[model samples]
Target: MIFYGKQSIAQSDIDAVVEVLKSDFLTQGPAIEKFEKYVAEYCGVKYAVAVTNATSALHIACLAAGLGKGDVLWTSPITFTASANCGRYCDADVDFVDIDPSTYNMSVDELEKKLQKAAVKPKVVIPVHLAGQSCDMDKIYKLSQEYGFKVIEDASHAIGADYKSAKIGCCKYSDLAVFSFHPVKIVTTGEGGMVLTNDKELHEKVLLYRSHGITRDPKMMTRTADGPWYYQQIELGFNYRMTDMQAALGYSQMQKVDEFVSRRRYLAKRYDELLKNINNIHLPDQNEDTDSSWHLYVVRVDFSKINKTKQQIFAEMKDRGICLNLHYIPVHTQPYYQKQGFKDGDFPNSEKYYEEAFTLPLYYSLTDEQQDYIVKNLVEVLQ
Candidate 1:
């Protein structure tokens, strides 16, 4: 019964959802704005816009970054499909940068090499914080400056994480950041997301885009107001608004983000110590001056040294009820991306990661006993 990842719901979260259900406003109400405020403050960012999901947040973030038809959007290949799909949704060309073998995030070195050899400069770059570990954003932001591209940090796995002693969503290293609140994430709102930005203009643009591109405020209106019931569709946008019920659950969950992270940290430390001597497996990496939220607890298997294959190990773990998983397959190798002209050998490092990576059970409520059982089964299977 130990799933790879699961939401930890508290009594407060349930009560908050119930309160929202009993309230007069269910969809677009005070709770939504309240949740936004909570996230903004928590991340140390100036503004935040709540949305239906991380995918929608990424889409709007791309729009706010001025991506459109004929423009090129670049991101790491080792991420969920949503990271790259945001660009396609804007009718832009999408490309990928390979990842660093050690951290499993986009490599600044590869990004620089790609820029040097490019005939067309990318207009947007999304650096994903895979598995709640922040990417090397300062270096990426430096390249962004030299190349004149906007950056959207896809921090779906890194809500409470920190880079260089600052919160991940602070926008200190990128133009904007997106966070997920799906059930498996550190925080849960049933299904929700938020985009963070310090730039007032981008914040306003996202706000406008969240609600069908309709603006009721006079300042953003392109024309004179018709009456008190006046509103305008300033741009073509989507119905990406989050509901008050979800926001209420998020708000309550936000109160426990620190506690959740602490428990995950403790569990991760235990795993590190317990498995440190296993020569055939490597633990997750931690860069200098950063702390991850320890989202997935992915470990890499050295298949060349082991008697069994990754497939065999995975099957054994599952058969023993460990519920192991892989964080991703290289996105460029997906059928959709292959049709876009990307194929095997386009990104060797990401493909290599796909071959060896495996995710262990990670969540706030995973007991020490459960984790030990999981690791014991994995070790025995590997032998």
Candidate 2:
């Protein structure tokens, strides 16, 4: 069966991890710093802090930005729960912004409308780069300036993607950006994440927060104590540091990021050409301005024209050895959020997307033969 997404591991990636295993340190070692440096250099950001996973990166990023009780955090509903849960991690009120029906990213126009009617101003706004296609950062950046809200880009799917010729994690348009190195992502570290920022203060805070808020740097100590043995617990933090074994794998994978992205883009282009002729299906959009990493090749079915419902289509595809999967459910529709007064109609576009959108097979290692089989099975299922 063709998986919807998967890792592309090689001897080099395996060797890197093996070398780490043979090294003197496995966690909190030189490999972690090396990996962080590689990502920071690649994204052209000043600092990169390695974390256990993207969710932890999001939580620490929200905390570093001062999102807490009495503050509202806004994000797109069409994303993994971590995008919204990061806000709740800080005891902040969470709210959803509808997505653009075409791009499936947070809609700047909807955000503007919501801000106008919002009883309280949001302190942080997280715009997810859904399916590796960046949200309109230029417009969102303008809104951020006008509304005085901090921007944290949920760029987990977009490490190798470019937004207007700028790397996604450069933070040229936002305060901080996060990337995932999950197995199915552009790169694999088994499970890891990184936070990138241009601001020195935020960078320092992220480093401190990722390691239990304990600072060994004498400069950051609250009071002058003994000798070099002096240290301090500056603030409450968590053990979110990524292991060196994971970092070694990430470092090796980072070397081939361009190649992985290029392959994925090529496959996506092929899928786009083949699927465009099909009726009752909407393919992903990639205008000349936005270059996507093509993390997942998603298509939305027009249920009105198709004889089968989404469930029936999904079941048929699965029975035919095609592992299709949905991208997300509207976060506000979750039972936990419903108790917070969120309901189905809170974000119309997100609700509509959840009903029809599903991801098809996409990965660097996926061959043309596999893709052909997937497309043929999909066509047969729809028929």
| Per-model TM values vs. the true structure | 0.98, 0.98
- Model 2 residue 213 CA deviation in Å: 0.7
Model 1 lDDT per residue over 1-383, tens place: 67999999888889999999999999999999899998999999999999999999999999999999999999999999999999999999999999999999999999999999999999999999999999999999999999999999999999889899999999998999999999999999889999999999999999988888999999889889999999999999889999999999999999999999999999999999989997788898998867999888999987998889888887888888878889899999999999999999999999999999989999999999998998888878888
Candidate 2 lDDT (Cα, 0 to 1): 0.92
lDDT of each: 0.93, 0.92
lDDT winner among the candidates?
1
Q: Lowest lDDT 10-mer window, candidate 1?
A: 310-319
Point out where model 2 deviates above 4 Å: none
RMSD versus native structure for model 2: 1.0
